[model samples]
Target chain A: MAAPPHFTGSLGYPPSSPSPRSHLHCLSPCNRAIKVSMSQNQSYWTCVTQKIEDQLKQLIPVRPPLLVYEPMHHLVFTARRTMAPALCVATCELVGGQQPISPNQALVVASALHLVQAALFTHEQLPLTDRPIPSNPETLTHHHAFAAGVELLTGDGILSFVYELLGRSDDPAGGNSERLLRVIIEIARAMGSEGMVDGQYRKMLCSVLGSEELCDVGWVDHVCEKKEGRLYACGAACGAILGGGSEEEIEKLRNYGLYVGKIHGLMLYYHNNRTGGEEKGFTDLVERCTSLALKELEGFNQGMVQTLSSLVRASFWDKC
Target chain B: MAAPPHFTGSLGYPPSSPSPRSHLHCLSPCNRAIKVSMSQNQSYWTCVTQKIEDQLKQLIPVRPPLLVYEPMHHLVFTARRTMAPALCVATCELVGGQQPISPNQALVVASALHLVQAALFTHEQLPLTDRPIPSNPETLTHHHAFAAGVELLTGDGILSFVYELLGRSDDPAGGNSERLLRVIIEIARAMGSEGMVDGQYRKMLCSVLGSEELCDVGWVDHVCEKKEGRLYACGAACGAILGGGSEEEIEKLRNYGLYVGKIHGLMLYYHNNRTGGEEKGFTDLVERCTSLALKELEGFNQGMVQTLSSLVRASFWDKC
Candidate 1:
């Protein structure tokens, strides 16, 4: 239950741990390999996160109408963005992307991907259920409700802006138009009703209908696969598609992404909440998924996949 | 203002309009020409509305986890969609659209446009303001907050699905890739932070900052022009872009959409709210905007623009 001392503050996983919700703490770079190739990967992760952070800051400036842009800027910048953007940028590079000619494309798309993820994160803060409000009601102040209201508008606004970033082809006559359009569709499919939304909806259902019954071993795995796993899959696939990877390569990256996300989400959410038997099963799934992710990278040039392998190995170091 | 006996339930403009909040009643088709071109226009309106309605129903089916789709379906289907869809369909035909070879594209884009507008409409129902929630906070039920919560998630979900609809290029190899991408970008600009979101943000600010002073003549005009007007403008321009119109044609349709939306929104929300002198000024503005809309269609064939003109005249028939 203790915090991973070296990993706590690195990915915004809340410095104070020893809490049941400390699963997010274990997702940082493994300290066991911190002396060698891990540092290189760590630098890449740090460098890319800062780049995305700067680009996001530029994308959402502190303009007038502070109330609207304020929450949008806050939620996006403050999210624990260790998964999607990193996967996207790493995938883009791993596939021999057009780094010399046009590297900004990946950065832009990666940042936009972060925007969609952040919007979903904002939505997670909302209360959900069709049956009834929970029995205990807090003395809900008007300001609190108003804050929630601003967040609602801010979430919708961010999603709309995500499309704008992806679809705004600077040069319509360029050859990348088809690729960009396809990337947009891929992100949408991953984030729409069948993917993230469905996952969130099901998660809500589990909470209401009985997490004990519904979020069993398979349910948690299925939800992770559909929800966060699908998100990371689409993000990596988008990077491959944009980086001029072949269809086969994009599929490989996509499957890898799916595995990474499942491992990540499972690690983040279901540590203490699971029964010991369920935990064992979940742990087995994580090992299996991590292996599946690395298995996807085997066909690629091993020299090129260090970054990606680092991401996969990140979730389970000593266990593997 | 008793629901304009002939209008009322036609446009979902509540039949009982004796209340101060009755301006939405007046946006129905003007009755003066009901016997002539009006009937033809009415038929087209009904037919197109039905088509968009059917397309929307197919786009969002009743599936599992009714909690997610229920609010989305209810909001999209129940909105009084008399403005954007009408302008989009009418402008597409007026611009000599390729209706014979491929008619579904315009309908699809128009329907998607309605989805964005509908999502924004759902957000409007949420309480806004950085200030206190309002006086006389009644016995706040948990169900109400929970409904708002579902709607919040539904709004973001709908926006994400919209990009999927726009960017899911069925035949990516087709020559329409550029046009579709451009239309997607156009819609994003109109609905993003600077367009619909900004308009909503400002509208919220007006209510909190003092509707009396902040929402004076020019403020109202600007908000209408930016919020609803901008929404309609993008819808029509998307139609023109997808319909294969020239740059000049798309710009013209965009301007016309701006005017029509302004007239429709002003009519729907601000008749009783305006002072006598201000009402006259707004009436003059409406007339001028209507003329501007017609002027945009002047370069097109006279026969081709009858539908467009009918929509323009929809807001200010007797006044003009």
Candidate 2:
């Protein structure tokens, strides 16, 4: 039996070939036709290929075939592929030594770990930025911390460690380690003085701590300037570290981080403003942050930046 | 403040002291009076002490000032002081990982692996001694393949591999490999040609593929001989493996395994005991498997073995 001919032009059948049986027959030509067409219409085939290639240009390119033959690339790819599996095998051996765990227990632990990662990733993109740095200091700190948390949670060191542990513990009992680590982290984050609740507390504290009568205005400004600016920088640092970003990538991340942070802060401030707190300066700060997050978010293509924006929105409870 | 005077006799209270503040004080006084009376009457206190001391002469005496150093007599006492904290830590970690897990996705791929283990363990306990080994050599080959399959599925090697993977992937993505491995194994066990369904198919094939005249005699013996024996052994192996039993523990596990296998095989036979052309032994095999599972399960201490037994029961229909 002969192979079918390759379609040379548009995939669409010619309008004149309307019969169903004819269309099927046309679509599945002989192998001889396929071979003949390949040899005879090389240029035409190349043009068609180029057009399709153009459509898919944005997608990550397959590594060059020659690269697969290169020791460095081959080694790296193989290493990367095996790292998680190897780790998992080791973990299982360890667990097997300690005690056997039921398969069900293993499943539960694995699923739980995945959920934690998803949650942490979702939380990373909270604080939004706007026009870049050189903005109000207060907004910067909030953004930076949020980004830092994400980096700590998802960095290669941590992610790889987790993969290694899961891979090693073929026994469900082995999942206990991963489960414990996640729980401890979540509990620490939730309960820490600087965590979500504490963050809220700090915002309220800033109002009183920065007041003219109770605080030295210069001291308050100095603290905000130092802390807030550092936070903004931290946000960029976190993005670069976790996303395997370059310096330029870090700068872009920083901009996005700051924008998201400001927006998040502003949303909080705006919501708080509506509820009885009447500080005009705080209101202005809130407005500035919101504008910045939106503007920065708009700079990137919607599809490319959707994860970042969605993360930002989720951080501010916009999705809630 | 000066240390309270050491109590004398049994009461350890001054005679002139007002009645003790509580019921304990009253008992002390009575005890002391009795001790004094005995001492004076027949020097009975000394005699009683001697006897008591003699009875416990081989045991180390508790040092009066160091209650903390005393060895705990009860298992619960030791457990409370030692294992409780460890168990608490383990449970806390496990629950914490599970907190982020949505209820819907809680049943993960790892669970399927566990089900396979449980089923295999239950099937390994069949009472092979009760039935005669098939005289026809071909029947023996089928039995051996069935046993090998059980062994492969429930073996330590596979369990260890799973544990290793779970240990490595503490992060969200860590669980994927484990889940994938489990899903593959379960799909193989439940749906593959050599799996549970296939086991039934082979049994039926044995009856029809051979001479029609000898079908009833050969099929009856085959079904009866193969009755849930393997399942019992499988279940026992599952429990022992998970329980951290060593090679030395195999005899006990084998005992339990045979019991469970017999019950499981019987259940499978009963379920597919239909007649004529539609007599594909699937239903009967399933029924026999279940019966054997329940029977072998009964040999175990229900309280201690509940975890594995419940898993085996659930796996039959839990859909992994």
Candidate 3:
């Protein structure tokens, strides 16, 4: 239960093991790997994150109305991490950079992807149920309505902006209209009903209807696959797709993303929550997915592959 | 205060005048025109609505975990009207239909737009503030969380599907990658911060901070133009863009859409809530926008232009 010896503040995990309700820590092996990886790839992650942030800053226009943009600013700048965008840039570079659109253009698309994700995060935080009116209901009402309107619509705004980014074809990498359109469609599919949204819906039902009766591995895995796995997979696939990876290469990166997400989901949320899966089963899934992801990087740039492989492997080094 | 003479159930307006707090009824002149227009174009409106509905029925996939899709089904099937999609189709037809993508393709995009709008509508209904728990708080909590999750994500699901349709390039009209991308981008711009989302944000601020002083014509008009006008304009513009209308033609259709939306916004919400604008001022704005919309159709197919002009005119025949 004690914290990993090397785990530090920058990792953002708790000092000790994740508590029953806590859902943001990795295993010690994975935890330690992140610490080392963070130090090693400090510049890489920082640069990737910064690039996305900078591009979004420029791309998201500044109109007279500040209300709409403020929440968006908070959401983008203050997110937990730029993992999706990072994965995108890393994958784009790995795919040999053969596409007409540059990695920078991929990041622009990634920024829009992050915007959609940020919108989801914002909406998720809204009070699900109605609360009792406080003594000062007026202030509460105004704040709630205002914040809700801003956050909800901000997501929609960013979503529209995603298409705008592609439409304008402002890619410094020049124009790859066909490829850009393909990437847009792929991201959409991954996020649509059968993908991330489906995952969220399944997760909800499992919690409500399934309860203790069905808190089994299958349910957890299903929820994780749809919710987290799909988005990450989509992000990785998008990077490869936009980078002009071959179909085989795109599939590999997508699998890598799915596995990375799955591993994260298991470590992050299902550790204390699991009811049926053995520790070995969990570790096995992680091993399987990790290997699968690494396999996808075969034949890509050696440095890029190593970075991505390390990124994926570092998360599961505990049991490995 | 009485319902317009020709007005009936199909208009979807109230039989009597809107209450002080109510904001759904159109002005009597506009209302009467709609009734007469409804009778005149009963077939047109019905056909347009049915086309969108039928296409949507096919486009929105049905899968397992019925819970996730249920809300989407309800939202799409039970919308107030198919006006947005109707505009997209109408404009597509009006633009001479020379583009490779079919009218059906435009509908596919319009359906996506409607999905985003539906998502906005669904989210808007969620309580911004958490309400006091009722007697059975557990049931309330579960229901609230479940409903919130479903509604919030359903919007996202539909938004994603919109891109999928376009990405698949299933445009039976053939292929026009450049134009399609352009249309996609234009739609994004219309829905983003400077467009619908900004309008919604401004409207919220007005309600909260500008309740008294800022509740004038300018405020209402600004909100209407952004929230309502921009969307219709986007829809019409998409139709023209996809239909291969010239830049001038596309611009004209877009303007026409903006004007239609402006008139609707005036009659729909401001009739009972305005403070600065007189009835005369309201009439003038309607006249201006309507004339502008009609003028845009100067060289289009006579029949299509007349249909659109009539559609725009039907809302303002109060003076007639």
Candidate 4:
């Protein structure tokens, strides 16, 4: 099959919000933070995303095995904004030590992370039943049994691809295979059962158990750590691992990732709840996570970490 | 969750066959060949399977994260017979060089391959429609939405776990990381889009497109090469690569794997067709793959490759 015509080189963001919420609702409180952040450092994030997309375009195959590769290429290259890849790149720069991994390798890992998130996004949005109408029309079409199958398998394929890329070069970045292997294992562990998948399973249970139980703030926080926080944190941690950060530095960056991840999750939760007139300790939780994230970076060079600090500040606080 | 009482160490194989055909149908002409081979080397194949299972039981986790880990453990540890892992171990021994890869490391890689196959098997059998009554009641239950989610994510999680295991050791088998990295890449490439997933996508399309079109022998053959052949080829190829096999030995084992894999796929295809009164060049195809596989092993010591030769001969020619 010939490649799709619209599959041009330019990074045109798809016209859809990837969040689980499906509403024509007004700007979420989270978006208000984004609006302010964008106004202040719109160009910065734009350049970051643009660079990632350019690298991604070069990385993915543009031709056949269109069924598998196209889904992944479109998912990664066409997305408007992706925090995971951005966080990875930013953290890489923050922790750039005596000998850092190449920017190309960093982008390759980031892009793979993005593909995992995209796969989960697609899987989650698949219609629970093979019905005529789906809740989210944009994410998946229930018209074919194979569409879900492709998405599911493609997701599995990309997960394997992440390792394939990691093990791509010999003595990559002049680092031994053992170090790279450690990095690969670390990332996989974070994304595996105890991390992202666990959180997802918990959330699924909460939804089935219904709203009365969903309001258990502790459970929400727990899920937040797993579902959103772990991946975000993982993105930054991967960057640190590849950047040749010292053990202390890696730990610091990981803590920073965990806090920032929590902030992101809380903001998303706040936004979803705001529309439903549900409120909790949203601001308090956000404040705590933001402060914790900031504290982790205090010992590091402020100049190199500014973009990440700014990104987190803009994601949570009204002012940077 | 408490471990199931049936989680005994014994290798009482699951009652179900891994084939797509759901009906209680007799085997096609393929088993006539199996009957002859099994009759001759019945004790040999049984011992190989038993040894693999003993190692598998020790390899899998026996405790918590029951939802995620249990599915994987059960799938891998319980299956009666699998060609992937068997081919891996067999090929490793066949290519025993001066300083062969340690048996522990070979088992590690073999187990990972088994996990990938099990994951794919689980995902393929998942209900396409989330209705109460599925075509195959044995595979999945129609309970919580989380059930499918868990199965899908568990499949994905195991895929990650495969890589995680590869990178688990610091100096695996006293071999440098470079060789292990190569083995990991080879396996990933075989399982990725171009290999297993590609064939799976084709089969899904055929099912969705159901007609005489599904019987288009060329497309079916192409799918067979991908879905079944690559993984088996990958398994043996990985063994040869890791065992310090020379280039010629590696190529021979790979060809042997491809042929055996095709023979296996053909058997399943033939069995699935018998109830439908459909037939193709089943006997001819089996004869050709079997002969080609045996030819690849011709140069090796007769005693060294007896199990493999017997496997091929039994799988096709009837008498060992």
**Fraction of true inter-chain Cα contacts (below 8 Å) kept per model?**
0.52, 0.01, 0.77, 0.55
Listing every candidate in turn, what is its Cα RMSD in Å to the true structure after a full C-alpha superposition? 8.9, 27.2, 10.2, 11.7
Candidate 2 CAPRI level: incorrect
lDDT of 1 by residue, A1-320 (tens): 32222222233222231222111112224323342433445545656666777888999987777776777788777655647776787677767674442346777888888888878877665443243343212112112233555666677778878888877634564567788888888888898777888787776667567757676878888888877798899989988887788899999999999998887777665533544556567667877887788889887865457656666565432121
Q: Per-residue lDDT for A125 in model 1? A: 59
Model 1 docking grade = acceptable
Per-residue C-alpha lDDT of model 4 across residues A1-320, encoded as one tens digit per residue: 11122222122222231222211121133344554334323434455566666766777766875777788676544432447676776666666623434455567677767766665655555544432333223333423334666666776677667778778844644755766677678777777778887776776666555565564666778877886788778788877777677888878888888777776666565544443333435555666777888888887765445546655665421111
DockQ order of candidates, top first: 3, 4, 1, 2
| Model 3 residue A129 CA deviation in Å | 2.0
Q: What lDDT does candidate 4 reach at residue B270?
A: 51
The DockQ of each candidate is 0.34, 0.02, 0.41, 0.34
Model 2: per-residue Cα lDDT over B1-320, one tens digit each: 11112211232222343331221221244345565444221222132223222322222234432221122111111110111111111111222222332111212222222322333232222112222344343344332222221222222122222233222333455343333333223223222222332333334445435555545534543443332333233333332332234444434544444433433343333334424443444334434444554554454333324322332242221111
lDDT tens string, model 1, B143-230?
A: 2333555666677678878888877734564567777888788888888777887777776676556757777877878888878898
Residue pairs with backbone overlap in model 1:
none
> What are the models' TM-scores?
0.80, 0.22, 0.78, 0.79
Best by TM-score: 1
Global lDDT of each model? 0.67, 0.30, 0.63, 0.63
| Residue B122, candidate 3: alpha-carbon lDDT | 59
* Clash count list over all predictions: 0, 122, 11, 0
Interface RMSD of each: 3.6, 23.4, 3.1, 2.8
